[model samples]
Target: MVIPTTSISTDSLTSLASPSPTLDFYDSPEPAFSFLVQRIDSLLDCSSAQKTHHQRRLPSLTSFVRQVYVKCRLSPAILVIALIYIQRLQHELPIDSKGDYDTPHKVFLAAIILACKFNDDSKSRVQSIYQCVSVVYTNIDVNEMERSFLGVVNYDLYVDIKQLCQFIQEHPTLELNWED
Candidate 1:
């Protein structure tokens, strides 16, 4: 009896590594977006109250800051970095439908991941990004998310640092740089 051996080609491996879906499973807008925004606002109010009250404990202050950060979908440092990235992306890239890519959900996940990478001392790996995306979108496949991420970004366009600096200078009063 002769046994048949099959060899897996590079294309097959690449496909298996990053599976593309017929449609984005995580394309739906988060129903909780508004709720999250409200929650962040409430957290900020609480933090302000704490600041006003000298009796408030240090732990309470720390917790409030953490809660606000989590609710707002940001870290203090990452908020700045993400804003810079967005500003540069907007100036350098044309507003073409073809260039305008990624589902809102995917964009949110990418921003979070990018922010984490820029702000946090510890870097969030691709696996962590996959897990984050998976938690938010239960039905979406991780491989598909990774593939979609690569497809959405236009690497050819260099980020315009000067434009970003000007935008930052002009929008000095904007507290949260990347609200969306």
Candidate 2:
């Protein structure tokens, strides 16, 4: 299937590129983009490995994230925000134990939820958001994941416009290219 590109408006881009506070996502988008790309590669690598019985239910985390992006009808900017939150949560709360499969998926869901809440003007209800994620996870699982995500990220969801504009500039063809 061809994955669709998410578009960002010019007004949003201009505002995002301007200087903003430290909490903004675009304040340091370059590093975050680098980190996001590497982390996604690593996760894809992990998901590609042979699965044991314990990991049977887990879908491909990378593909699943893309699916969430498409199913939620999220803008590319929101996708970037979600990715940033995922990175932040991962950094703050590393998975030291063996059962790591579920954690990443949970974090992804939580990041999507947070991103939608912050970026989308017409908000998606929590239940509906959970419903979109429920295909791969239970409601209870999603709730736990959301709570864990909030705790780890300290509920900071502000993304800078500059970093966002930088990301769009760096990935000019992200929306137009269908190579993924």
Candidate 3:
């Protein structure tokens, strides 16, 4: 699969691999389009992703993502990295009942949280992010979700520049908007 857009090239993503606050791509300004949400919706639909049972109805993926996008100050790069992490976790799983571990919200939340921490150098940034997410998931729930995510990937958090480009190339339809 190839990305149809010329704007978001491998070179752009390579630069964003070590994003800084000064870069326009590092901080998410409110999106005018819901591109990431649409891509992720299709991803979960196509992959071996699962959801948990709860008394109350879970929030829609779009809403969940939007809230996280703004509240967590997430960029397209961070969300793309989260997608990479989620796909890696899915690939590592058994594709059976044992793999059906958590709800998509929890999984998504965990991925975003992990991405936030991994992308940023500040402990305060991640801690503040955790506080924002803990309102939806208890601190314990978030911790377990994080641990499960890490364990599935065998504590391998690194996504090299080549590998990241490869992942984007493989899932070209999920083209991230690199421009503001």
Candidates in descending lDDT order = 3, 2, 1
Worst 10 residues of 2 by lDDT: 20-29
Most TM-score-accurate candidate: 3
Which candidate, 1 or 2, would have the higher TM-score against the true structure?
2
lDDT by residue for model 1 (16-108), tens: 122311111122112123322332232211222333222232233224333333444343333333444444344543444232112333333
Off by over 4 Å in 1: 1-73, 92-94, 98-102, 124-133, 138-168, 176-180
Which residue pairs show backbone clashes in model 2? 16-161, 16-162, 17-161, 17-162, 24-160, 25-159, 25-160, 26-160, 26-163
Full-model lDDT, candidate 1: 0.34
Off by over 4 Å in 2: 1-5, 10-55, 94-99, 125-128, 166-180
Worst 10 residues of 3 by lDDT: 1-10
Ranking by TM-score: 3, 2, 1
lDDT of each: 0.34, 0.55, 0.57
| Residue-wise C-alpha lDDT for candidate 2, range 77-122, written one tens digit per residue | 6567777676576567555523354555666677777776666443
Task: Give all TM-scores, in the order shown.
Answer: 0.37, 0.61, 0.65
Error in Å for residue 146 of model 3: 0.5
Clashes of 1: 0
